[model samples]
Target: MKNIFKFWKKYSFVLLIAFITLSLFDLRFALAAVICMAAPVFSAVFKGRFWCGNLCPRGNFYDNVVAKFSRKKKVPEFLKSYLFRVLVLVLMMTVFILGIKQNWGDLYGIGLVFYRMIVITTIIGIVMSFVYNHRTWCHFCPMGTISSLVSKSRKNKHVLNVSADCVSCKICERQCSLGIIPYEYKGELLNHADCIQCGKCAVVCPKNAIGYKST
Candidate 1:
């Protein structure tokens, strides 16, 4: 099961392509967008931003496309601010709502909205890749924002922690795509709302100090 999960995480971009193709050619598959939209919420209840870390097609885009071609740059402090994230979320949701209302119960229209969303996100991901470090758009993704909120609400579940063996080396910080300073929070259960549970910190820790633990 774990290997299957890793495989899915590694190749999730294929699902994104498949989704786009289905949306363009078969209206019946339009409902997949709805399922994708709701998946973050459901997954967050159990594993906190697991969907973002392992199942998000957008994250796959960053990993496969953006990271391959872009220069690494530090994300701006302003862009990482919670207020900016909320504003971006509001704007995205407003656009999404307007698109839904414009489509109004038609499968083709719904599919078109999903299609446009994928295109727009892809473009944004490409643009952001050139301008910022890995997965910078994730900081402001509306679905990610919502998932973070849900994870925060259910703080006791699926928490990551650090052990006393931590050397205070900042490798985890460097490994973190979201800019979280894991060493600083060592020895404490991490429930940071923005934590995507990507496990890069845990994987890179030389002492294997960081890991998941139930609270």
Candidate 2:
């Protein structure tokens, strides 16, 4: 966990750079949202969320900015429920599509809708981090969820591997950024769909039992 945090911190400024284009630039900058979404989705097919852990600007923002002042409470169980995540995903995407349809002709109008979405969602993530754990919002983020699903689409996708020597210490579970219980899927791939390929579990395991494998 320490190593992973240190790694992301080293490049955390990327979030600020990306946010500047999204917020400080013209309406056209809102198109950045699509690129951001696509980056992770495309990577998930071959790498199982490598983009999320290594390159997601918002994830970096949470780790670097929000973690500083977060209250660090346990995430609400309701927020982690699959039903709730699906509902949030459906609702947000519905709103986005509707907004796009409403402004189908004018580029500025479409950009305005995207801009509003990025701003509102980011604020929600930041507020949730302060209210709960720094990564509370990550557990069910639409983009993360989508990346997980896309990764799962391929058989034998690379994921955190738990070897026979695992000490069952549960450190990996505790350190997982998305609250995934890695220990539960012992001697196999982690069963959870939110791994993010962060490798924090592998980094913190005292037994040196966790590693990545196609399984």
Q: What is the TM-score of each predicted model, taking all chains together? A: 0.92, 0.85
Write down the lDDT that model 1 would get: 0.80
Candidate lDDT scores, in order, read 0.80, 0.77
- Weakest lDDT window of 10 consecutive positions for candidate 1: 27-36
Give per-residue CA lDDT, model 2, range 1-215, as digits (tens): 97876776567657655655765567767766787778887878777777777677777787777789888788888998878888889998999999999999887788888788777887798899888887887777888778778776763346678888887898888787577787777788763566777777999989888887644
Highest-scoring model, TM-score: 1
The runs of at least 3 residues in candidate 2 whose Cα sits more than 4 Å from the true structure, single-residue gaps closed, are 1-9, 16-22, 153-156, 213-215
Highest lDDT model number: 1
- Which pairs clash inside model 2? none
Candidate 1 lDDT score at position 128:
84
The window of 10 residues in a row where model 2 has the poorest summed lDDT is 15-24
